[model samples]
Structure formats: C-alpha cells, structure tokens
Target: MKDIVLYDRNCHFCKASKRLFEKLDWMNVVDWQALQSVNRPDFSQEELMEEIHLITPKGEVKKGFFAIRRMLLRFPLTGLIGLILHLPFLKPAGRFGYKVVADNRTCTFRKK
Candidate 1:
C-alpha cells in the first residue's frame, strides 16, 4: 500500500471526501493534508496550485480524477473502479466531471 497524499482544504466536499477516504482506507494508507498545511514535506505550494494533486508512495503525482482514483485504490472493490476510471474512453468525462466539482467547491463549501 502506498502512502496517499491528498491536497485539499477546508472545502466541505473536500473534507467530506477525506472523511469518506478515511472510512474506506482500512489499512491506514492515506495521509490527508490541507492545501495550507505548511508543514508538508513532499509538495510545494506552486505544485499544489498547478492542480488538485495526490502523491503515491512511489512518489508519482496524480491530478484531477486520477487523484480521486488513487484515493479509491485503498479500497478493495473501489480499487477496481479506480482502474476502470483510467480507461481512455472515460478520460474526457472524468476530467470534465472533476472540473465541475472543483469549480463548484468554493460555493459548495461556502468558502467564498
């Protein structure tokens, strides 16, 4: 199991997602971080602002839906879904969906 680094903040959805991952990640594989967690050792702010990022134990950076997929990999059944999410046919839809969720995050989280 890889150490999952999730770059998120105080957004309601982001926080909810983190909690959900915590529930699903039975092996204690994830290390959640706020975008403002200044103590992060692996990722820089510039790198984070460039995209919604996640880093695996192998240190491979994933962004967008791929990051979501990486988090899902912690669960057995959901891991299969994560693999399917990487299919070429689903890439465009996944990217678009991620953008929709991200764009609405501030509003949904009442951050603005």
Candidate 2:
C-alpha cells in the first residue's frame, strides 16, 4: 500500500516519466499499476483513458492535471510545476495542456 498510486503501464512516455521520478527520490512516494493489473470497479478503461488516474491512501481519486499535480507535490522540482498548475487561472490552461498531451500520446505508442 503505497501512499500515492498512479495508473500506468509500460507506456513509453509514462515509463519515461516514472524513470525521472525514480531518479529524483528513491524514497518511492508513488506506485503504479498497469491497467491490466487491477480490476477497478470505480473506473472503466474508457474513463481511465480519458484522464490520468491517481489514488491516495485515503481512497481519494484524482484525474487529469489534478492527478499530475498530486504526483508533482512529492518532489521539489515537480512540486514547482504542480504549484504553477494550482494557480486558479492556470487550472484551465493546465487541463488544456494535458488534453493535448493525451491526444498526442498515441503517436509514440501504437497498439499492435
């Protein structure tokens, strides 16, 4: 039971992101589960695909930029990025940025 959990598999970008976090703090504030690794009644594949997924030990679920922001808070560098997104006016911009990234992620990882 990790304190923070992110839903991701071997996605190239996701793996890259995870590697960066791993390099920063071996303390391991986060855990990851491939979509296939768990049966989550609360979220369907369709829903998960539409947003980033994060679950806290408190059983709170957060999605989109909020999820990314949550993960960023664990590390100093990323915490800065997260703080930027936390700005009220920047929230919508952060969401737009996430959608753009999410929409383009398939270019890097194609399904067989």
Candidate 3:
C-alpha cells in the first residue's frame, strides 16, 4: 500500500528530510504532501502542525513518532531501524526523542 507523508513546507528541516526520503525510497512506496496543502477532513490544521503524519492506503493515520517508525518500515534497509525503534526497551525512549526533535526542529536547524 502506498503511504502518504504530510510534512511542514515552511520548515527547512522538514523539506530536507523529504529530500532524504526521496533518495532513500528505492521502491517509491511513499507519497509526499506539504502540510499546508493538506485539507483532510479527519485532520485539523493544528494537528498537522503538531507533527508529521503518515496515512496508509487503508486510511489509517499514524502521527508523530509512530508515523516515522511506520514510514521507515516501508523500505527494506530502514525496516530494521524501525524495528529497533519499536523494541520494548527502546520504544518509549524513541518516542520521547522524536518528540523533542519534532518540537524543536526549526530551532535545531537554525543552530547549524
């Protein structure tokens, strides 16, 4: 199933991340949409701004850290990274780390 990734266009980090995904997506299994362009009835603008979103072809939505893990699993190489992130001992930590990064992505990038 094709996956859709909703990313913030105004964020340099988000845009760079999308470009990285394009390079890593050997199977072309994911589709990209700018968060500002999304008008999904199920997701409010504020919700989209809160974090990244991954929507499955079946219409299931995975948000924030979960979305990143799910997207990683779609590719052969990154699947292991996704699996590792979800390991019982690491899941909580991974989620926390992702949240920190997501929340400060703009500032994080600006520091560079």
Kindly list the per-residue Cα lDDT of model 3 for residues 1-112, writing each as its tens digit. 7899999999988988888888878899999999887788888998898899998999899988888888788778898998887788887887898899988898877525
Prediction 1 TM-score vs. true = 0.78
Q: What ordering of candidates by TM-score runs from best to worst?
A: 3, 2, 1
Candidate 2: pairs in clash: none
The local lDDT score (0 to 100) that residue 26 gets in candidate 1 is 80
Model 2, runs deviating above 4 Å:
108-112
What is the per-residue lDDT of model 2 for residues 1-112, given as tens digits with 9 covering 90 to 100?
4544455674666667667766765557777776667788988878876766888888999887888887787666677877777789988888899888877775765555
TM-score of each: 0.78, 0.82, 0.92
Worst 10 residues of 2 by lDDT: 1-10
lDDT of 1 by residue, 9-111 (tens): 6466777767777788887777876777656667677767545777778878888788887777657758888888878999899989888887787676553
TM-score: model 3 vs. ground truth: 0.92
Query: What's the CA RMSD for each of the models?
Result: 2.9, 2.9, 1.6
Specify the highest-lDDT model's number.
3
How far in Å is the alpha carbon of 103 misplaced in model 3?
1.1
Off by more than 4 A, model 1: 39-51, 109-112
Instruction: Report lDDT per candidate.
Output: 0.74, 0.73, 0.87
Cα deviation at 30, candidate 3, in Å, is 0.5
